[model samples]
Target: MTRTLSRAACIGGGVIGGGWIARFLLDGTDVAVHDPHPDARRIIGEVLDNARRARARLISAPPVPEGRLSFHDDIAGAVEGAEYIQESVPERLDLKHEVFAAIEAAAAPGALIGSSTSGFKPSELREGATHPERIFVAHPFNPVYLVPLVELVGSGPQDEAILDRAADILARTGMHPLKIRREIDAHIADRLLEAVWRESLWLVKDDIATTQEIDDAIRFGFGLRWAQMGLFETYRIAGGEAGMKHFIDQFGPALKWPWTKLMDVPEMTEELSAKIAAQSDAQSGQHTIRELERIRDDNLIGILHALRANGWGAGETLRAMEERAFAQAHARAAHAAPDPAAPLELHRAKVGGDWLDYNGHMTEFRYLQVFGDATDAFLGHIGMDADYRAQGLSVYTVETHIRHLAETGAGANLTVRTTLLGFDAKRIRLHHEMVDGAGTVQATAEHMLMHVDTQAGRACPMGAPLTERLAALAPGQSALPAPDHAGRPIRDIGWPLGEPA
Candidate 1:
């Protein structure tokens, strides 16, 4: 029997490290923590609780089914044989080198080693390491469990493969991994954000704006747009007629203006620091950091949850999450995969005694048969019926792809979701993801259908009335193909279909 790689190790066990542990464990990966502090386990447990609560807002799916956590007193013991090692110790250069030495010695040679240093560049962190190629910066935002972005930067060729694997694992943990083109201090996002931080510090030091006011400026203004689409793209739309170049041409001269003092560093004088700290305390005296953390979590959940509805970035995260939850629930209930939530109408055949083959599960071809029935039903619902076909109007399947993931044995009741991908004057495209009642995706179908005129027995344009009707149905889905299937096919599967429907 082959064992799944679900265990990971975190070294140092401080705030950020504890967060990495929380994120991994909450995402269904068993985690081991290594920290010399005698209170490491307690601290990590608290962090995980916070992380879990924060994750609650963003993920509506069931809890990650909980995973085991082990505390290792020894660093080598924690890293030994682990598939991935996340090093999140304090960001001191010397300390990172010291820790990496041990990590290199203990972690499996093939294991990816990620250093959670917000300040140190990958080259600098891996300077003295024997496994330089395997060590890279995996800088995550503070409060790692809530934030979805990770900045991956490294120099060596092996770094790409390791980072790609890390991206998969991070996606599993519900994070967005962006691989940086070059090794730079503070990676990508932090660098862009650092400029604002520096200016915010200046404003505070000069008494130009209150912290709350700066926050208000962001929240009430461009912040919301930036959350969905970042700076350049947002600005390009704002540029009007000619787009990006026109906008740049009009605004390029502003770059030379003294609107920003980015190069100016703020002095952390005792008086200035004291004043800032006092103002921060005054601004949030009503709540503790724990309370603020809860608020942040709620906001993240709201924002990401809303985005998930549209199948955006954070929304995709939610879909991925819901799939896992549905999968786990089905496992526990020992039921077959059924239909997930969909906008279109769907139906499924219950698993009968004869549905099971010699392996005691539904066979592969049964998926096609069931889905074919579903397609027929859906087309019938949407003005495509025997009469319409007799008039030379029908849907032709141009392409299909199915995946078998799990087995649905005899006596297992199953359901499916059929979604209208889009429709045009000439053709219709549809997608179906079959899941259990618990919401696990079992199989998916992407179908390209051409409307045919029965009299000519060939493809024909869809009537305006029918197109208008479909517009009322799928809405915006008709404009373009989904991001995953752009310019490629009439239809293609998005999720794996396990066994049978």
Candidate 2:
């Protein structure tokens, strides 16, 4: 199993399959998709579009160049020479068996085949297959492009190395692959989800709550808690410092109190189906499915970003991936020298829809965030890297003045340029310009940074390495005139206070 997977085959192009394609492609793996659905291309395109937008907003580090995507009408054509193959056809066992048989015939001997089946066990999916060892369930949550969790189930005499290879491949695509210890009907997460889902259905069947109400109860309450910390850990906190044992002792009795109808399932009669459908429609029918998807992606991005900031759960995964991306970008840039004629163009990003305000323009705080990232890049380029900070020496921003020159909207591509204005041992002044794709300035920022001995909590002289690099950049940038917006006083007007009146 190579760390660098070049090509992958997707055997379906519905929601889950498209997500697999989007995740693979975004992570720089070329994808070949095979699907017989007439609307496969259109559905996958929509998913990819949402994926691209969400990914841009979710991570700030330089993205890997997206891999080429090609659609194939036949499974053999798609799976040929593919290092990895993911099957996401309908949930029917016979259909999956047919698809797996076709894939096994054409797929390379070493290629790992993963099925996106939520309900079927890996043993069942591998039944009657030539290479059952290579066939396993790699179940993923909906909108798989954004969610990081992928359940990996492998329970056969097949090569153990093959299972490890599958995990490696999924990790490379920015997923947290949880290996199932044993084969189960639905595998861990879905089983837990099914229990809750059954309860929610019972509530609707009893007319105690509508679909939206059930959703609201989850999203507004435990869902937020679950996102960051799972059930047991959350309950551990509920023990009031006594710990899990105490909490379980207190709440364990309630488990048998018949609070939930976990053993019972509501019959999906026509009346119940129509009731659920009508309620769902009335709750969310204002938006089309595509619109709802965008909304979901946007909300997920916000939640993930917050988690990333805190380095919790899925956020931890995202942060790790971002650090890897940043390091890779820096490594690539290290091979090339910065051009003296141009300001260092190291940071690039697209304005996310979440950054917009009521006026439909990028808000103020994001401007500073972009500038800060550019500054960090400049620091990394000048030998002020993680090791430098780890040694208790770093530069801290002391002052900043930002000037908004032009309005930029969501999805606008942005490029940042960092100019060394002035520098000495103790402090450095920098000017950053945020420009759009057309090379028009959207905003400008002037920052003064103080070199600090972080442990001492005071300003300190920078090391010779950083000083030398700054000296090199300063001379070239000094030849250019000071920006007109620099050093402008914060005032209502430049003239005398009463002159206009």
Candidate 3:
């Protein structure tokens, strides 16, 4: 089944739970939410709006139809038919236990339960529970829809299957499911965060740095390194010809030196809290919370795109998701029997804000990207796939001519209507019309393609279904009227000799 997430229930719809909801729904999972907060619906709606914008920019895959969103009066109603349940209520032992009881009472049998607790252990959350084995920690970072990591922890060895299943479900939704080996008080990331937080508080309390200055230290320095490579991995490079052991040997003793006050947490007096709050306000007071979130989302998208180019770290995860999305699209197309007689519509996509340039229309390069994707979709329509390419035969673009017909704005839903101009044994001449949702032509491209034996690095005749499929479609496609500019090149606009000389 392609549906990894059929239904998900969120017990709380604050920032974290709201993110979980958006992540699930945008991945095409129906979600039911329960929160007693009077403004629960509005809060979730606002978060969903932000998530929608971020996803449009962050992911280029035409999003699957969003899953249905519903709010329930109580937790029981929310968890009724849910296959996955995430709890993100306020942190407390008794409250969690009570919620777990309510959830387990009505949740489907064997449905997975994950707690978003930052401090409580799985063992603690499992206490007095009906299905204690099902409960585990699925803690995520803030702005959870965009940040992919969900630190998964179980109490002991009993949850290997549960962990694997949970990880699979998360991976399908484009999340990196990191399984923790053992249960600790706050799990892995939060523990590390606590250490950093303690040191930062001390820095602030001693007036060593203002909030902005402290933030600058991170944003300008190791934070970038930490993003793609974590602490030890980044430091291994710091060893310079030597490795981790050498770096540790050189810098390990510094750990023993009294250069930090990690153990001694500063007292949380009224004065210190006020000082920290005032400094934070002064530093970022110009932007509202939502505005800051948008900036962060944009920055994260840039970083992710960079990492994806290199195929390292989180970028690898993103690439895998993109591959999966494309494969799914191809699969759906393959299953369908679209009329080969008509203009074959194999691909469509929405123009997100990221696709726009300074002129507020889709950028120049993205048009080619869209046409290229449509070309792939066409190849897939004729049964080209990874398996076929593995045989060292593939299609390559030899030449292309594009005419920008109209300026398309952001949020325009684009559909590529492809026509087969002509074809030979080794060459396929194709034409593509890029149209917006309203049927206006935004652009058109004429491409000459050559099938090649990848290993031989030369043109080759296509075999089997590809040729057969093309022959089958040629009858109808060949009869269609050709565009006047199909074989034309850019018009020469040489300046008049006398104008400037």
Candidate 4:
């Protein structure tokens, strides 16, 4: 199957489907979504809200607006012409089978169908489908829009290639897509999660610890290590330069002891589920889902930013992010102004850590923040400083659009360049570009800012004095060399910030 994607479908508009939308749309793929549940629209809208926040948290530099999201009442409407179909309905086997059947009937022959069921094997999911080979499993963690890992399992002929395609697509979604060798009940990641969960259940059942205690044990301990390097590599280092062989030799014998019950699978009694759910509620009784999502996005951004600082798995993610930011900044800067004498100071700013998202790049809002700062600085330079504002005057951005051309990583030196697009008595239209130390433009902000009176908080005219300064500045202002497509403001999708000749 062709790897290039145009449209994708998320068949369920719940949390998981919303995540799929977040992943694909943030990465620039058009998405069609369907859900029969009465609250699907509201649920997906909530998901999109979370997705916007998630994108802002992880992707430094603004991500392109999600490709058009078409909500459909019928499954066929969502699946038609979609290159990929992600099924994220409830966790019932029968329901998944029915959904897969519908997907098979609706999707084109080339489209790949992915089931987000955590426990079901692909063989079982494909049991009733006509083209079982096109179907597989793509199990993502909760708060799927933020977490990058997706456990992919494929069955039947050419399964490996299908899995590869899925992995590529997930990578484009900024996820760490893992392909397990064969089918298992819960696949590799969840199996690891299950092992810990089962042990946790045993602890809770035996009154050894509470739910939060188990969570603290993992989170405060090995979870930190696992994010950068997997368990085996960490253990190898823990072996003191003896390497994997020596490490295994020294500790392998402990496997025979009663350190863990490796073969145990806990029974999912209602009592156990209720106990877990109750504990979860007790832990987070006051926070709404949106609030929880913001918290998660904040923590993930912090952790990932730290990882990027140390050059971990998040580092690669960061590099990709920085490149993107530079590209967009360059594009926006390029189109903004007509020609000028020297570099225009759009804003002088400080970078914040919160601007770093899960991908360890700058967030979308910060890009505008920086651009706005740059514009303020330029206006100040041209005699629109606070003193000017002290006389009941300031600038307020009324309309703005940002285009993300490349990714930007944490701690990369970036500066904003402003080009005076045009100006009127009451408003100034400007373009701002953020560039890294290496002179790569990552993102651009085009804003329509209105003059305002600080005291009245209402629109005001640019005085004759400020207007003269703007004209003086405008004569010296010039846009950057046009990128490949000069006539259009938007650039090629996912285009790189090319090396300067």
Q: Please tell me which predicted candidate would have the highest lDDT against the true structure.
A: 3
Q: At residue 426, give the lDDT of candidate 1.
A: 86
What TM-score does candidate 2 get on C-alpha atoms?
0.86
lDDT (tens digit, per residue) of candidate 4 on 1-501: 224457999988777778888777766789998888898778778877777765665555534535888989889999999988999989999988888888888789989888898999999998978998889999998678767778899874579988988887777666777888888888888778878877888887676888988888878999888978988889989888778889889989998888776577567799878888888788787899789877887888777777767777865666555445434444443334534665674443434555677888778777777776566556555566435656887778888878787787766677777767778889887777788878888887788889888798789788855788777766555443433322245434553565432
Report the C-alpha displacement of residue 308, candidate 4, in angstroms.
Answer: 2.5
- Model 2 lDDT per residue over 14-60, tens place: 99999999999998889999999999998899899999988888888
- How much is 188 displaced in model 2, in angstroms? 0.8
Q: Alpha carbon lDDT of residue 145, candidate 4?
A: 71
lDDT against the true structure, each candidate: 0.73, 0.88, 0.89, 0.75
Residue pairs with backbone overlap in model 3:
none
Task: Compare candidates 1 and 3 on lDDT and give the better one.
Answer: 3
Better of 2 and 4 by TM-score: 2
Q: How many residue pairs in model 3 have overlapping backbones?
A: 0
> Model 2, poorest ten-residue lDDT window?
327-336
Compute the lDDT for candidate 1.
0.73
- Models 1 onward score TM values of 0.66, 0.86, 0.93, 0.68
Q: Rank the candidates by TM-score, best first.
A: 3, 2, 4, 1
Candidate ranking under lDDT, highest first, comes to: 3, 2, 4, 1
Q: Which stretches of candidate 4 lie over 4 Å from their true place?
A: 1-4, 262-278, 325-417, 420-501
The lDDT of model 3 is 0.89
Stretches of model 2 off by over 4 angstroms after superposition: 156-160, 336-338, 380-398, 422-429, 449-501
